[model samples]
Target: MAKIAYILLCHKGPEAIIGQAEMLTAAGDYIAIHFDGRAKPEDFQQIKAALADNPNVTFARKRIKCGWGEWSLVQATLLAVEAAVQAFPRATHFYMLSGDCAAIKSARYAHDFLDAEDVDYIESFDYFDSDWIKTGMKEERLIYRHFFNERKHKWLFDTSFHLQQRFGLKRDIPHDIQVQIGSQWWCLRRRTVEWILDFTRKRRDVMRFFRTTWIPDETFFQTVVRHLVPDSEIRTRTLTFLMFTEYGMPQTFYNDHYDLLLGQDFLFARKISPEAIELKQRLGALYSNDKAEFKISNEGTSLFKFLTGRGRIGRRFASRFWETESTLGRQRELMIVICKKWHVAKRLLEQIRQVTNVPAIEYLFNEEHTDLPDLGGIQTSLGKRTRHRRALMRMLFDYYETDQMIVCMDPSALDLLQDFASDRSTTRMLEVQCVFSDEYLIGHAMRVGLAGEQTSAETLERLLPTIRGDMTFESDKIRDAEFEHHYIINEARDAEENAAPLSNFLDISHDKARQIAQSDHLFAD
Candidate 1:
């Protein structure tokens, strides 16, 4: 029989904490809990009373008020660790976990597995040499001192951090020790835990150095393990399986993830939502199935590994864009609607959407209308279109498989538009009704025999020459835009005639486009 002491740090969710305490004690293990000082007193009383019958459970001597990116979290964890060791003298190993973590397998399997291992299961990496820190302060986290809490006082934290950098306020770490960083979760042998606790008590210099360091909980224990423990006993991985988003935030799992969680190789998973009632209930029923001898695999992923390796892998996501990208799921759909004036373009978009009865998302690259409509299923970062237009389309197509999306752009962006129509695309060349020819708006004034006497004739007199010269001047530019088939809008022909050579293109009107959207003739291949 192997005894493992569990040190749990909890901030919220009292009922969940009591249930966890009961489960661990039932598994023949000892547990110590450190409740956050900021929690309500009534909540603490409820948790304490619920676990009163368990003799294997203990509480921290003192509670600490914890905040994000502060050293108070490390202090709370240390208190729980000490209480667990004192209460369970026969425990051979120590495991640190957050309140949200739950065992996917039996607790007996966890203790039996750890009891069989000689090496400690903790992730350790050289801080300076490793690319563990991705977004925020890397070397500066250790070089300069941070006083204000980053979450509570963001402005003050940034101001002080910058002022220290501007004046070269630097701190020197002891020359004998090397700084190491890793995940906050670990499962360590009792001998290793005792060594770490003893050193922190004796070395006041190391404690002071880590107190002001950013997120010291990640560094303090990891640094101690490397500086004090033998190299052969350290295994550079954690027992927890976790994942993070591209923005470095943890991905939360819900009841829908029950199958995914059970298929995982690790025994424990952190950051499960407290509101996931079905997940908690189903997983709780399986807690007593703790079989010995390799019931679960030791290989597991950590947050530190996920963050550093994010940008390197090929992404496979947001596949809902496929139906909108092409007429059918198989073809790539795109069209180049070249109308010089935006007023003509807007009316043309309305006609297509009304006739086809299909959702049409327009104004992607037009400068005047970058604020896209609230179109669902379109999950893209709009900022990328401004800085890297070509890269944005490539990334967009990677997530959204599309062959039939109607794309409207100014002639200037046509250079980057070619990539959207690849070898397997079924593209369309669309020409809309000319702005001046339309009878409703600007062209109306001139159409009703008021051009000669109108005071605005001066502006229109100068504009007619450019309108006459515009399409003919842009004939070569239009043909090279990589359009699959050119379709002339069968309204009254105007200067748009010069933009498209009549002999080489197909003729399509409102009726033709509507027909194409309903049936799949143009993309049969």
Candidate 2:
């Protein structure tokens, strides 16, 4: 049987740590804990009282104060690893985790699983090639020396990082080892742990260089294992399931996510919420009867794409509309069409372009994009060109009304209505709605967002060349005259008779339509 040594490096949540320790020990696993050096005395005492009598658990010597993206975290992890090795000499697999990590599978299953495997599990990707790190400094992380903890002294950290780059101050790596990066969570064979620790001790100069390296905990052991271990021996993946958001924060597991945790092949999951008392208890009781087959449905990649696409909108050009630095921004008369249906919106866009004569921009502010170009060809303002681009934006849409009242059509940025509602310039807004989308109406199933999906099913007649082409149409007549607020209910689709009366439907649907326009919210004050 493979005896697993679970090395837990934790900062906060001592009670959660106690639960994990008890759970691991009950599962016939060895435990080593490194409570953050800066942990509260009372919290530390509670942990000690809970696990002090347990034979399977051992405390790491010289518990270091862990800081985000600093050397202390690596030190804490190493301390726990050493303690585990000394306390549990029979352990074959050494699994790394944090205080919040808990066993989602039975110990017998994990033991049998690893006992059969000859490979070590760790994420080892080339640092230079992989686009893993989301928010912070990437290549710059190694190129410059980070002195201050980024969380505590963000300004100083950023300033020093840039200043070093500005002055061309560069540091040399000890052995010029190709820096491989990965998640800190790893499930390694005892030999790998030994090799990593020995390498850490032997390469004091490497350790010295890593002391000032950003997020050394994520890089140090990963880079070392890749260098020492053969490719065939390493699995290049972790048994532990942990997810970091694009914002670079660990997504916390809660009681509701119990089924989600159970469904995965991961033995353990990191960063369980301290408040998830029921979740912790449920995870502690997870003991499988048979050795489960190791087919994992890791929702890591799928969930990350969703989370990143939704959260990191600033990185995309479509989401950007406002500029902080504005000079001489006089109010301008602008007409904006707020519509979700692209076919209907495109038709309106054509009419506006005809009325204005200089390309009524399609989806200038809409986050989502289809095959059609998203940026509106003129919305982007990268780096130094931002000034002139912003000037052009102001000239085109904001500074003053053009001779023919040039329109700026956007499908997603509904907030723009609220922004310009109270402006001195007479702003006209047409909240267009297609009865075809009555099934996916506002405030319900439909949300026009940065999903990059174009929801349009215009009929063959509507998509005809005559209607779609550059011919002057009836819709163009609407733009010829000035209108403050118009609700163009596009009755394009076939309306079917339902249980509800026509009068009842009209009353309820139009009321919702008015709300969708959100004109009242803008002009309420």
RMSD (CA, Å), each prediction: 17.7, 20.1
Give Cα distance to truth, residue 94, candidate 2, Å.
1.2
Measured by TM-score, the strongest candidate is 1
In model 1, which regions exceed 4 Å deviation?
A: 291-525
Q: Estimate each model's TM-score.
A: 0.59, 0.57
lDDT of 1 by residue, 450-492 (tens): 3544547567666566654554456446666646676554334
> Candidate 1's error at 62, in angstroms?
0.5
lDDT of each: 0.65, 0.62
Report clashes for each candidate as comma-separated counts: 8, 0
Candidate 2 lDDT over 336-425, as tens digits, reads: 565545555555444333222222545544433321211234434333223343434444432221211323444334344544444445
Candidate number with greatest lDDT: 1
Scored by Cα lDDT, where does model 2 land? 0.62
Look at candidate 2 and tell me the lDDT of residue 201: 78
lDDT of 1: 0.65
Mark the regions of model 2 whose C-alpha exceeds 4 Å error after superposition: 244-248, 288-525
